[model samples]
Structures are given as C-alpha cells and as structure tokens.
Target: MGGRGAEICCASIPRVWYPGMMVLVRWDMPDGLKHIVKEKMVEVEKYDETGSIYIHFFPNDEVRVVVSIYPGYSTAHPIRHYGKPENINP
Candidate 1:
C-alpha cells in the first residue's frame, strides 16, 4: 500500500532525532487516513518544549503533532514507536 509520497509499503519512516543522526519511527495511521496514507513516511516538521512533536506527510502537507505529558513520551494516535533499528523497545 502507498500514499502520496510513498513509493511502496513501509512500516517505518526516517526521522532526525538528533543533529546529524537519523532514526526510524514506526506508526499506525488513523483508520480514516490509512487508505490515503498507507505506509507513507511521516515527516517530522518540528518539536517544541512542551514535548509536542509536529509532523506531516509529503505532497499532502497536512500537519499533526504528538502531545505528551512527559518528555520523550507521546500520546498521539498516529505515532506508535520510534527508535534505532536495533533498539526499538516501544
């Protein structure tokens, strides 16, 4: 399955977690958008001090963010897990 910016099905998306470093984020799309965004890479637009991480999908440019009560924690439905390849404990 694929979406606007997606060339093929993918379970993960590359994300810049630190300067010069990239990680992958595994997520689940809302049921309504799954057909439109199947396995597409979710692009992170920015982050804020409130533990909110902003994100968007390519071509569509619709922005979403994960708000959290604790640092490094997310309460957003679109996000499932994020980490390096070898240590994705979430």
Candidate 2:
C-alpha cells in the first residue's frame, strides 16, 4: 500500500482465530508479534460481543495490570507494558 502504514499481517494466526471470537485465556503470539511481544503469554481476561474487552497485562501474566480500559469500546485499544524477550524480560 502506497503512503500507508506498514501492516504486519499474521500469516499464521492460531487456528482458533475468527472474526469476532474471544480468547478465553492467555495466548502467545511468538511469531506474529515477535517484535513487540517476543514470546510471552498475552492474557485476554474476558470479552463481550459488543462491549468492553477485559485484558490483563502483567509481568508474569498472572497478576493484574495497573492500567484499566474503558468499557463498550468499538475500536482497537492499545495496551501498554506488553511483550517480553525470548531469553529475558522486556
């Protein structure tokens, strides 16, 4: 695409992927998101059909993240402090 931001398409997104499917637990994007999130388990706390999406981002993926997201959003939301290194912490 000319004059457009680079898009990193997931050539191999998990087979569980769908148009509006919710992740029940943490999921790792080692290949698709290696740059930003190395090989970490990105937690997707909860999800709704047309409402808020609860996401938890912790250093260990088992704790609660400090930041909170607004409910009932209809757009992509960015999460801070996400990702990790393959051999070390990010």
Candidate 3:
C-alpha cells in the first residue's frame, strides 16, 4: 500500500470474504531498511474520489505498528496478508 492513507480503513475491513485467510510476507529489507509486507487477495479501494491504499510501516523503535492494504493479488503464492504487532498509545 503506497498511495492512499487508508491505514485504519483497510485494517477495519472484516475478514468475512477472506475466511481462513492469512497475511503473506513479501520481502524484508536488510541493513536497517524498513520492513515491507505484501498482502494477497485483498480488496483495495480508493477513499472517495481522491484516495488510494498507501501504507508505510516504520521501524519498531520509531512508531507504532500498522497494517496497510494494497490492490493486487499473488500469482504463484497463497492468498494471505502479513501481520505485525500494533502499538498501544499510552
């Protein structure tokens, strides 16, 4: 997800259509690069007429964890999106 700011919106979508589904891990950057996961079989939609699913995750020590969604499907892999620990604001 890298265009729309629908982080909370995407995460809130129910898993009804995606039953027994799991998130998938696409690639993880090394050498202190940010961790990026690629989710499959997810229904991504733009917010209103000027929004899209653009998600960006920060380092663990930088900000809270978040789940983002993008519009796409896996061709040769299983349909599952990645999952990360969310942070609790105190």
Candidate 4:
C-alpha cells in the first residue's frame, strides 16, 4: 500500500448488527483528516447476479454510499452525512 489512502478492512468491520452502527475508517492523508462513517444498507435494482457496495470518503470527514446493481456497471446515489466524534452530544 502506497500513497494517501483510506481503508476499512475486514478486521475493523464487525459481523453483527448494532444500533447506530458506525465504523472508523483508517485514512492516511497528508492533511490528516478524520475518518468515521455511519453504516448504511439499502436495496438496489439488481439487473444481474453481480453487485457490490461501496463507501466513499470525503475531505470534510464525510462519506457517500454507492452500489452496483450489476458487474462492470456503476451508478450514483444520494450522499449521506454521518456523525463525527465531536458531533456526538453527551
């Protein structure tokens, strides 16, 4: 792995479902941006047997969700805002 990157490996992800599911994505950037995003799940129209889910990171500590309904294909979905560490209230 080289250059700036962000990753949420399988070790960091859990198999069980929890309320308010959130994951900390490891982001390695020169500017040192925070990486955390809420877990989202949605259904998409499956045109074929191949499909995938994607998580997109942003500079402002935000994330966008995308899904592929079929292989070798891509589509755009509405962006969603997740809570940061500071966004939480006591």
Clashing pairs in 4: none
TM-score of 2: 0.23
Q: Tens-digit lDDT track for model 1 on 1-90?
A: 123332224323234333333333444556764533344334343333243342333333433333232333333323433332111122
In model 2, the worst 10-residue window by lDDT is: 1-10
Report model 3's TM-score to 2 decimal places.
0.21
Candidate 2 vs. truth: CA RMSD? 12.7
Model 1: runs farther than 4 Å from truth?
1-17, 25-50, 60-90
Model 3 lDDT tens row, 1-90: 222223233334333333343333233344456665543332332122222223344344222222223232322112123444332222
Per-prediction TM-score = 0.23, 0.23, 0.21, 0.32
* Backbone clashes in model 1, listed as residue pairs: none
Model 3 scores what on Cα lDDT?
Answer: 0.31
lDDT of each: 0.34, 0.31, 0.31, 0.35
Residue 22 accuracy (lDDT) in model 3 = 35
Give the top-scoring candidate (TM-score): 4
Model 1: residue 50 alpha-carbon error in angstroms = 6.0
**Which pairs of residues collide in model 2?**
none
TM-score-superior candidate, 2 or 4: 4
The predicted structure with the larger TM-score, 1 or 4, is 4
